[model samples]
Target chain A: MCTYATVHADMDGSAKGPGSEWFHVTAATVYFDHPVHAMAEHTLNIDLADAAKGPNGRVALELRADSARALIKAIQDALDSVPEELRV
Target chain B: MSEQLTARTIQITGANGDEIQAYLATPDETDEPGPRGAVLVIHHMPGYDRASKEIVRRFAELGYDAICPNLYWREAPGAAPDDAAAVARAQGGVPDERLLGDAAGAIAYLRALPTSNGKVGVIGYCSGGRQSVLVACNLDVDAAVDCYGAFVTGTPPEGSLRTNLVDQLPNLRAPLLGMFGKDDKYPSPEHVAELDDILTANGKPHDFHSYDDAGHAFFSVDRPSYRVAAANDGWAKIAAFYGEHLATTASTPTGA
Candidate 1:
């Protein structure tokens, strides 16, 4: 269906990008659309990127809907396990 | 049979006269007489990747000069195709006006070639499919092919950036060949039927074929959605349609 809906978030973090080099990530673009490599017809895709570093400066993931939801829960659980004071 | 052809990347004028990257393919010059028709291959929303380039070459092998403009060049120049697509998608995708402009540029480039027969056809897959119809309605194209394009007759989800071309259908200026999969949800059976009715009522020439056992992207060989039978038959339809509309005749004049 090539869903055109996309959600963008500004972020301050670092991730391993092309060439296995770590780059400061400035934004996250999330969408449920056709995947480049995934076997499924559609998947939840996330691209963590550093715009200033050009296109190659991206860390990408394509997960099934269920996998994406599970990942979200996992992230929330990991954050919750930290002390309130340590959460930031 | 494989035809001798040459393919390369070149820069062409796009929307606002911006120089953007494009892939161009043409059959090798031989003793073959008369100029050849041209085709504008619109890449899907996935951006101008290798598959899209291969499609352009396929048209060339079919003896048509073909070109595919990089729709994301303005946003992510020098970027890998997938990266460029991600960047473009985040930006709400390419605007309709900009798409029309870039298509016009590509068509112009094809027509300007010395070997062109001044006839141009357009073919697009996925999102490009809808754009193909949009371009046909707004431009002076000879033929158009829409391969399972969504939102051409159906409503997109709420807050989605996509829109249908119901109003534009009345202005369709070329013969259209639509290939769809009955199992596909987007542009489902009902939507395709609706489109068929509108074009019929409008007196627009259209040939639509819906495959029973296929779904969306049946023509995408690299994807799991690919349906060999549907894809092969769709290709045959495309070739026949273009042959009828784009073939050079003795009475036809060359040049843009």
Candidate 2:
């Protein structure tokens, strides 16, 4: 089923995308919906994009529900391991 | 019918008279003696990709001129299907008015074809299913098919702009054929029941079939959700439904 629900965020970051080039991504769109290429029926999809650079300037990920949750915890743990001043 | 058909991307005036790309398919001239009924195939939320175009070609092989307008053209023109879909999704999806206008334009384009029999129907999968029903309610289509579309009988979740189409039920202007999977939860069995009840109350003409042991996107061949048994039967039912309601000899009904 198409979740038809989306969660959006504004962020400032650079990510390697198409053509192995790096581009500044300004927005993140997250949703749990049907995967475009994943083998699973549904997955948690995330797209970090720069709208001004057009559709090609983006990175996409489709991870299973469990994997996505694990990723969240891993991200939190990595940040926690860093010193407060160095984290910034 | 022969498998010989031609399909190509063509520009058509769509929502707000914008020239948007669309895939149009027509059967070989030798297969049919004269004009044939047309079908406006609406692609799923996955965007207008190869799978949807294959469906359009299938309709042509089945003896109908079929066209699928790229609903995401205005969002990310010339972008890949997945890319365009992402842009459209981030933009809160296509507005209801824009879709309505696009469908209307596609219908007109089909009707104006020299070999058109002046009869047109609409069929859609996933989100397109709900949009198919929406067009039937607001346009002059002769037939409408909804394949496992959600948000038709139940409300969209909070924060989503899509609303239930129950109020628009009374405005339906064509015969509707709905196919659903009993195992699907979005348009669950309960939701299908509710839709049946409302269509009955509105005195609309409809035929609904729910397949057992299947779920949403059962017709999507590329996905693991594809159920061959259910999809085969659903296709047969769709062909017959269009034959009954969208045949050239079928009587035209007054539009709302």
Candidate 3:
């Protein structure tokens, strides 16, 4: 069944998408629901998209729940490892 | 029995008079000139993709003119199915009023076909399932088939765009046929029972079949949830139900 649960947020980033090309992503849509290509029935699906560039400017990910949580922590850890002055 | 059919993408007037994309399937013209009923096949939340188009073709094989409107067209016109679906999902999904207008438009398109018999039905899976029931309550369709649709009875999770249809079932205008998996929790057995009770109390006609050893999306061949026994039987049930309610008749569209 589709969970129909979504969390939308405005963001700024660049991610590689189809054709191995990279584009600036302006928003993120996150949800835990049935995956399009993931082997699992349900996963933590996220879409990083640039609405101005249309639907093609999207980088999608479908990770297992635990893996997604680990990724969140890893991102935080990577940022923490960098000095504040260098990050700025 | 599967038969020779032709499928194609076409543009039709959709909700708000928007020219939206749609997939249409029609069978080979037979020697006999008998009229036939038509069907509107609503694609699931995943958008209008191959699997849903196959179902549209299957309806043609079953001797009905069928069409599945691309609900994501406004968001991602000409984009791949998965990509379009992703865009629609991020945009908060299709609005209910738009969905109803699209359905009504599809029905009108089908009835205008030369072979139409003025009877039209609707069948939808998953999220489309709930939309199917919703349209039946608000439209004058001949029959409605809801396959494992969630939120028709159960409360949608808070913050979700979906909602239960308990308030609309009383206004259902057509005979309803529902297929479910015993293991589906969204519209679990309890939810199904509650829907049955409500429909019965409202004096609405309905038939529901729940299969054991099956869960959500049991008919989705591409998904792991597909159950051969359940899907096969469910298909048979749908054919019979449509045959009875959407039987061909010598009449014209009242546009109802």
Candidate 4:
């Protein structure tokens, strides 16, 4: 068994509609050949608010790492599926 | 026609008689004008032993006092022979905690510099990237940029690097922007989105941009995975974001 799973990863779009129109995360080119070189996992947290006459406010993220590589295919598939709009 | 930039250092006493050294880069005092803002740049696991001053030098070009502190100074030479060796030092060790704490102190130290305008920002790569968010979460600085940092996922959390960054994302008083590569193996897109979701949900003013074609450390020119296009775009975005949020404007009361 692959022992992996797939996720939206916001490739389809973080908040919806076209991919290009949404924010995107790139790939791990350094670890493809050696999945173990880049394996890691952690959760991200953010707080929303109103400021400077702006609708959105500050956001923060927390990450935790184990070794280097965790699951490869799941992350790759999400990248390949991102909408054309999100592609760099 | 580029003027010669100056390089200098400062000695900081960490615990256990360890003397921490920092690398500082300043624009030519001969320049016709002063800097726009001041920024402290932190390097990744490769240490100050790797990479160029040009990245931080570019900050000086933008008219800001720039400093890149080497957090690894506490270690003896040749300590981390490889990535794993460095990882061992970074995960759950006194050096790691002290380095991070020192980073916070560096922020304060810069804020006090005679050249400082009280407005400051921080930028980091890889481990340094993770630290940028961590520092901003715990401080009252102007802004921060986290480039392709490792993120957390799942209920229990998976990272053992021992950084509390992922958990503190919701508490940043200043706007933080994170850039990641979608194809990155360590920090998957799912994880990146989880971060975005948390920020959006909390009403935090943050934006995470993951380049579709780029990968981990894509901005790192010295690495094999460096993506020219992505790095260029990222640099522009970061600069603009800082200009909007951190830089001082004639109309704004104080520029951060």
Predicted complexes: DockQ each: 0.75, 0.81, 0.72, 0.02
Error of 2 at B68 (Å): 0.4
Off by over 4 Å in 4: A1-88, B1-4, B13-19, B30-32, B77-96, B152-164, B249-256
Per-residue alpha-carbon lDDT of candidate 2 for residues B1-256, written as tens digits (9 for 90 to 100): 5468888999889888898889999998888644678899999998998889989998888888899999999999999999999999999998889999999889989988887878899999999999999999999888999998999988797888688899999999998999999999989999999999999998999999999999999999988999999999999998888877666664542121
Q: Which candidate has the highest lDDT of all?
A: 1
Clashing pairs in 2: none
lDDT of 1 by residue, B75-171 (tens): 9998889989988887789989999999999999998999889999999999999999999999989999999999999887777766899989999
Fraction of the real A/B interface contacts present in each candidate? 0.71, 0.67, 0.67, 0.00
**Model with the higher DockQ, candidate 3 or 4:** 3
Candidate 1 lDDT tens digits, A15-54:
9978989999999999998999999999999999988888
Query: Candidate 2, residues A15-83: lDDT per residue as tens digits?
Result: 999999999989999999989899998899999999999977789999999999999999999989998
TM-scores of all models? 0.97, 0.97, 0.95, 0.65
Give the fraction of native contacts in model 1: 0.71
lDDT of 4 at A1: 7
Runs of candidate 2 with Cα error greater than 4 angstroms are B250-256
Q: Comparing 1 and 4 by lDDT, which wins?
A: 1
After superposition on all C-alphas, the RMSD of every candidate to the true structure, in Å, is 1.4, 2.3, 2.0, 17.3
Model 1 docking tier (incorrect/acceptable/medium/high): medium
Best by DockQ: 2
What C-alpha lDDT, on a 0 to 100 scale, does residue A80 get in candidate 4?
90
